[model samples]
Target chain A: MLEISGLVSGYGRISILHGIDLRVEKGELVALVGVNGAGKTTLMKTIAGLIRPTAGRIAFEGSEIAGEGAERAVAAGIALVPEGRMVFPRMTVWENLMLGGVHPRARPYREATLERIFDLFPRLAERRDQKAATMSGGEQQMLVIGRGLMAQPKLLILDEPSLGLSPLLVQETYGALRKLNADGLTILLAEQNVKLSLAVSNRGYVIENGKIVLTGASSDLARDPATRKAYLGRL
Target chain B: MSAEVLLQATVQGLQMGAIYALIALSMTLIFSVGGLLNFAHGDFMALAMYGALALYQSFALDAYAAAPLLFFGFFLLGFLMFRRLVQPVLAAGVLAGAQLTLGLVFVQENFLLMVFGGDYLSVPTVLSNKNLVIPPLTMPWPLLVGSLLAVVLAAILYVVLMRTDFGRQVRAITQNSDAAALMGIRIDRVQAIAFGIGIGLLGLTGAIIVAQFTLTPAMGLDFTLIALIVMVIGGLGSFAGSMIAGAIIGVSESLGSLLYGGTVGAMIPYAILVLVLLFRPHGLMGEH
Candidate 1:
């Protein structure tokens, strides 16, 4: 489980995330939906410790982890599959995965975790020795997700996993997310793809201008008149 | 020119080239990993040489025996420098980092000048003036031994970069620092070690070459320039490229001196560097 409250963070002096309050229960997939520049990435980064929060608390399983930095966050069992599919371009898929398991907590389970990841993304297994940069975009996306799993994380945070992906690849990615949640993994996914995200998540929050504008069960938010009008493009 | 003379020149060039390669490799490592130009790199080598000189003067230890001590001492000094100075400016930009290191050049040069004065100094080991003769070719022991040790150090460095977990982390950081952090790597720790190793290598270079060359307080700038030329010619971050480029510069300089004159030979590396930049800017082994 993870809890965040009044989390204010940004690049330098300009605050992008202002007083965000969010939470995800154990074994739940929570979607943070927002348009471009709506502070979704900022909130995720703050939780993952890539950006130090200027205000508020981030509690991962009851211990405060605010501003602990990315290394400590990963050691505390949080793995972030960052936006833009930032795989080490020069490294092979196996090398990327091996690095993903470099955390001490994950190192002991690296072999086992790698096998599970390979099972989840067989394309990665087939291209184990291939450089990540040479792989197709969809395959790179799979590699990043598989890399996150290699960390054996208690909480997996993903930022824009479906961005730049083809529709078919997007569906496949969402399906993988669904499967991951079904396997009792807790996930925090930030996305602009409202329809697919709501469909896959148990609970969802609509963020706008660095504020949470709506929160409810996935189905309820999907059908809500305002949510439908703004996000789903329907009434 | 006779064939024997040509062969001798080539051999001598290669021996010097080996040493240049080590210096260039150190520069490349720091640049690739820490993202700093490390203008103080050559000064660090000069400081290492002085450390060896001091050791030799005090305990009558040969430069060869003082090498391990210099290597580890410089490593620690480099590590501390990164933590205290380099890391802070790293996020500011390349210019900021370069300026910080450039400042270090003055500090180190001044410190050495005050302690040792401006006189040229050399360490006299047993092998200082000795030469190994074989038929028509004779190799000075200092140059021969220095080149061999340089190659051995380079091989050890290669193994460390290719085989170790730290090496993997280093490569990971070089490719993508953000992604590396997401993978749980302590970026600062890895970078500090890398900076240390980069400067620490100069320790080995300094100790080995102390007997081969005379040291002046201002000689650090020349080595820095040579390293910069070598790094550029070899490609910015390629390890193999630096070694090969170092050899190319050394051989050309050696042959240039033999055929033309000392002035022209000194200018040869610059000519080659310009040609490399004009024709293949990325370097021989660099990725586009």
Candidate 2:
């Protein structure tokens, strides 16, 4: 479970996120949909502890986490699959995944988590010894998501998981997210693909210029006139 | 020149090159992880040398025996330096970190001067005056033993880098610090340890070379320049490239000195560096 209120953060004197509030319950897949530069990443990063909030409160499972560094957030069981598929280019896929489980909490479950990840993405198992840089873009995306799962985090946050991915690959990725959610994983996904993101999410928030403009059940939001027109391109 | 002469020069060059390669490896580790082009790397080596000398003088400990102690000590010193100095400037950029290290060069050099008084000092081990003779080729006992030790140490480093969890985290950070952080790695802690190891390696070099070369406070710049040249020639972050480039430089210098003269020999490594820069700027094993 996670909660945030009045979150404001930015890069050195240039504020991107204004006062904002958001929440996600356990075992729910929540989607934050916004256009490019709508502070989707800024919010995700703030929650994951990559960027310290200028002003706000972030509580994860009843504990304050705001302004804590990334490592602390990770130890508290928040794993973020960052925007760009940032895999260690020179390392093998196995090495990349192993690094995911480096946290003290995750180390014990490393073997089991690794096996589950391989089951989810068998392509990775096939290329376990291959360098990450040599993989295709879709495979790299899968690798990053698998890497995030390797942490065995209580809350998994993904920023722009669909960026630069093909439509079919995006569908595959979302399908995997659907299964993971059904299996009781708590996920927070930020994406620009409104239709696809809303399709799989239990509840969704529409972010505009760093503020949450709409929040509701996925079905209702998808059918709303404003949401359909602005995001789905059909009214 | 006779074949025997050529064989002797090549063998001698390789022995010395092995030590240079070890020095270059230490430099590469720091640059790859911390993104700091430490100008004080060689000064740290000078410090290690003095440390070895002091241990020898005080306790009658052999240079070889003092190596592990020096490594552990320098590792702590480097760790503290990173925490107090390097980490603060790191956010500013690589140049800021480099400038900090440049300032460190002055501090270390002056400190050594004040203590050691700028004398070219050497330690005489039992092996220092001995030679290994076999048929047409004769090797100095110190050079043979030092090279073998250097190779063994390098192999140990390679194994650690490839097999350890810390090594995995290090490689990950080297490739992408942001992603490494997302994995819950303490970047500051890892970098600090890495910096310590980088400087700590100078302790190994100091011990190995104490008998082979003389020590002076001002000697750091020459080694700094050599390490820089080796890094460039080997490709900035390539471990294997450093070893090979070090060998090339060493062989060229040795052969040049034998064939042409001391001055011409000293210029050979620079000439090779220029050619490598012109032909393959990324280095032999470096990839973009």
Say which candidate scores most in TM-score.
2
Kindly report which residue pairs in candidate 1 clash with one another: none
A138-160: candidate 1 lDDT, tens digit per residue: 99999999999988899999999
For candidate 2, write residues B209-233 as lDDT tens digits.
Answer: 7888888898888788888888899
- C-alpha lDDT (0 to 100) for residue A2 of candidate 1: 94
- Candidate 1 per-residue lDDT, tens place, B1-288, comes to 899999999999998888888899889889988889978888988998888889989999999989888889889888988899888888798899999989989999999999999999998887899999997999999999999999999888888876777888999999998999998899899989998998889987899888888888878887898899999999877779989998998899999999999999999999999999999989888887
The regions of model 1 sitting more than 4 angstroms off are: none
Which structure among the candidates has the greatest DockQ? 2
**Which candidate achieves the best lDDT against the true structure?**
1
The per-model lDDT (C-alpha) reads: 0.91, 0.89
Q: Score the docking of each candidate (DockQ).
A: 0.82, 0.90
lDDT of 1 at A207: 96
